[model samples]
Target: MTVQEFIEFKIISFGDYFVTPLHIMQMVILIIVSWTIILISKQVVQRQINSGRFDKGRGKALFQILNYSIIVLTIIAGLDMVGVKITLLLAGSAALLVGVGLGLQQVFNDIVSGILLLFEGTVTVGDIIELNNIVGKVEKISIRTSKIETRDGIVIIVPNSKLVSDNVINWSHNRSVTRFRIKVGVAYGSDVSLVMKLLSDSALEHPEVVRTPEPKARFIDFGESSLDFELLFYSKRMFDIEFVRSDIRVKIDQKFRENNITIPFPQRDLHFKTSDTFSIDKTK
Candidate 1:
C-alpha cells in the first residue's frame, strides 16, 4: 500500500480502538460523579428538612434541579463522545417529538406536580403522610414519584400525580403535634358535668398529651341510650397515637371507677314469641 494510505488506515484504527474505549471510561466516571453528587445533596437536604432549618420545598426543589442538571450534563457529555450531535438529533425529531409529547402528557404532569410539591413545602422527608391510602414517612421524592416507608416497615412508591390529584393527610406539615380523638360512652343517667371533669383531668395527667392547647372533653350527644363524650388532645406525634390513647383510656377507666362513673356496655333488648305446642325434640 502507499505510505499516505497506510498512515490514514493506522489513524482510523487507532481512533476506533483507543479513543472509543477511553470515551466509555470517561462517561462511566462522569456518571459515577453525578450520582455521588445527587446522593450527597439528598442527605444534606434531608438533614435540613428534619431539623426544620429551612423550607423543605425549597431545599428539595433545589436538590432536584441540581440532580437533573448533573444527570443531563453527564448524558450530553457521553453523547458528545460518540459524535452524536444532540442539537441536530433534537431538531430532526422536533415534529415527531411533538406527537410523542402528547402521549407522555401524564409523565410530564407527574414531573411537574412533583416539582410543585417540593416547592410548596407542604410535605418533607421524615414527615408523616397519608397518600392514596398509603400511610408512612416521606423517604425519597423523585421527579416522577415519592417513596414512603410505612410504620409496618413497608416502602411504597406513589406517583406524584396521585399526590397532586388526591387528598393528602400530612400530620407533621405545619407542626409536630397531631391531634387524636377518643370517644367514650356512659349510661344515660350518668352526670354529664362530672364526666367532663373526669375526662379532662385524665388527659391532663397523661405525659403524652400536650398541655398548652389544653385537653378538651366535649359532650357529643346522647346516643341511642348512652351519653357520648369525645376527648380531644394533641399527641407529640402520630406514631405515638396508639400508646397515648391506650394509656389515657386506662387512666379514664381508673378515674371513672373511683368517681362511680360507669362506661356502659352496649345493650340490646330481645323478645321471643312461641306457641305452647312447640317443644324441643331431644330424641331426634
Candidate 2:
C-alpha cells in the first residue's frame, strides 16, 4: 500500500472513533516538540533566575505554570488527533469529576495553597521556618507539597495546606539576623554587674554574633535560689544557630568559672516540727 494510504489505515475502530498510524505519528511529534519547548524554556528561565533579574522562587513558579500549561495543551492535542472530542468527554465525565473532587478536597486545597505561596512570595526557597515546632529550611515548593531540610540533614515532605494554615515562623524573612536567648541562673550573692558583663562579653567574642545591634544581658528576675539572667544576641546564621548558642554558652561558662561566678542549683530548706500527730518511727 502507498504511504498515504497506509497512514490513513485505521488500527482500531469503535462506533464513531478510530485510531490511525497518522494519529500515532502526530502524537509522537507533538510530545517531542512539547518536550523540546519545555526544555528550552526551562534553561531560559534558569538563566534569568541566576542573573538576579527576578526572585528565584517566583521565577520557578512562573516556569511551573508554563510547564503545566504546555503539558495540558499537549494532552488536548493528542486526544484531538486520536478523534476524541474534548467537550463531549468532559460532559460525559462531569458527574465522575464531581465525586473525585469531593474525595480529593484536601488535595485541591493543597494545590491552591501552593499557588498562594508561589504568588505571595511569603515562603520561599532557603528560608528558615518553624512549622509545628519542627524547624527546617525550605528546599523546594511544588503544586501540592514542599520539601524542607531540617538541621539534622533530614528532608521532610510537608503539605502546602499546612504551610498556609499553620502559624509558621520565617526566621530568614526580610531580616538576615535573628535574635536568640540563653538563660542562666547565678548564685544570689554573685555580682550582678559581673554576671552581666560576662554574658555580654561572651556573646561579643563570638564572630557569628552581630555587633551593630550588640548583645545585651537582662536581669530577668530573682528566683528562689538564684538570680535569673538572659543573654540575647543576634546572628545571621539561622540554620545552624544552635551551634552558635552552644559556642556562646561555652564562652559564658569559661568566663563564669574564671570570675568565680557560680551557676547555682535549685535549693530548698526544710524545718521539722515535732508533733504528736506526725511522729517519725525511730525503729521500723
Candidate 3:
C-alpha cells in the first residue's frame, strides 16, 4: 500500500466514528501540546506567587481557575478533533445531567461553594478557621473539599459547602491578629488589684501576645466560688493561640504561687433540719 493509503487505513470504525494512523498521530500531538501548555501555566503561577505580585490566597485561586479552564478547553478541542460537536454533545446529555443533578445536588453545592470561596476570597489555604467547633489551619482548598490541619496534627477533609453555607469563623480573614481571652478565678477576698496586675503581666510576658492593645484584665463577674476575671490579649498566632494561652497560664500560675494567691474551688454548705419525728441522737 502507498504511504497515503497506509496513513488513512482505518483501524477501527463505528457508525460515524473512525480511528486511523493519522487520527492517532493527531491525538498524540494534541495531548502533548495540551500538557506543555498546562506545565507552562503552572510555572507562571508559581513565579507569580514567589514574586509576591498578588496575595498568596488570591494568586492560588487564580491559578486554580486558569488550570481548570485550560483543562476544559483542551478537552473540548480534543473532542472536536475527534469529530464530536461540543454544543450538540452537551445538548444531548442535558436530560441525563438533569437527572444526575437531582441525585448529586450536594456534590453540585460543594462545587459551587468551592467556586464562591475562590472568587469571594472568604476562606483560602493557610487560613485559620473554626467550623463545627473544630479549629484548624486550612491546608488546601480543592474543587469539592478542603483539608484542615488541626493543632493536634490531624488533617480533616471538610466539604466546601459546609464552609460556604454554615457559619465559619475565619480568624485570619480581615486581620492577622485576633483577640482572645483566658478566664481566671481567684479566691474571694483576694486582692483584686493584685490579681488584675498579675493577669496583665502574665499576658504581656508572652512573646506572641501583642503589646499595643496592652493586655487587659477585666473583672467579668462574681462567680459562686471565686472572683471571675478575664485576661484579654491579642496575638497574631491564631492557629497556635492555644499554646500561647497555655504558656500564659503557666506564668500566671507561677506568679500566683509566689504571691500566695489562692484559686478557689466550688464549696457548698448543707444544713439538716430536725423535726419532731426525726431527732438526732447525741450518744450513738
Say which candidate scores most in lDDT.
2
lDDT of 3 by residue, 1-284 (tens): 99999989989888897888987888888879878987888789889889978667777887787777777887898778768899999899999999999999999999999989988989988889999998999988888998999989999999999999999999998677899999989998899999999999999988999998889999999998999999999999899788899999999999999999999878898999987787889999
The runs of at least 3 residues in candidate 3 whose Cα sits more than 4 Å from the true structure, single-residue gaps closed, are 1-7, 277-284
Give the candidate order by descending TM-score. 3, 2, 1
Consecutive 10-residue window with the lowest summed lDDT within model 3 = 54-63
What ranges in model 2 sit over 4 Å off?
Answer: 277-284
TM-score of each: 0.74, 0.85, 0.89
lDDT of 2 by residue, 1-284 (tens): 99999999999999988999998889899999999999998999899999989567667877877787899999998998887989999999999999999999999999999988887878888789999888999999998999999999999999999889999999987777899999999998999998999999999999999997999999999999999999999999999899999999999999999999999878999999987787889998
Q: After superposition, how far is residue 145 of candidate 2 from its true place, in Å?
A: 2.3
Task: Report lDDT (CA) for all predictions.
Answer: 0.81, 0.92, 0.90
Clashes of 1: 1
What is the model-wide C-alpha lDDT for candidate 2?
Answer: 0.92
RMSD of each: 5.9, 3.4, 3.0
Give one digit per residue, the lDDT tens place, for model 1 in 166-265. Answer: 9999888778688888999998789899999999999999887889788999999878868999999987868547778899999999999998888887
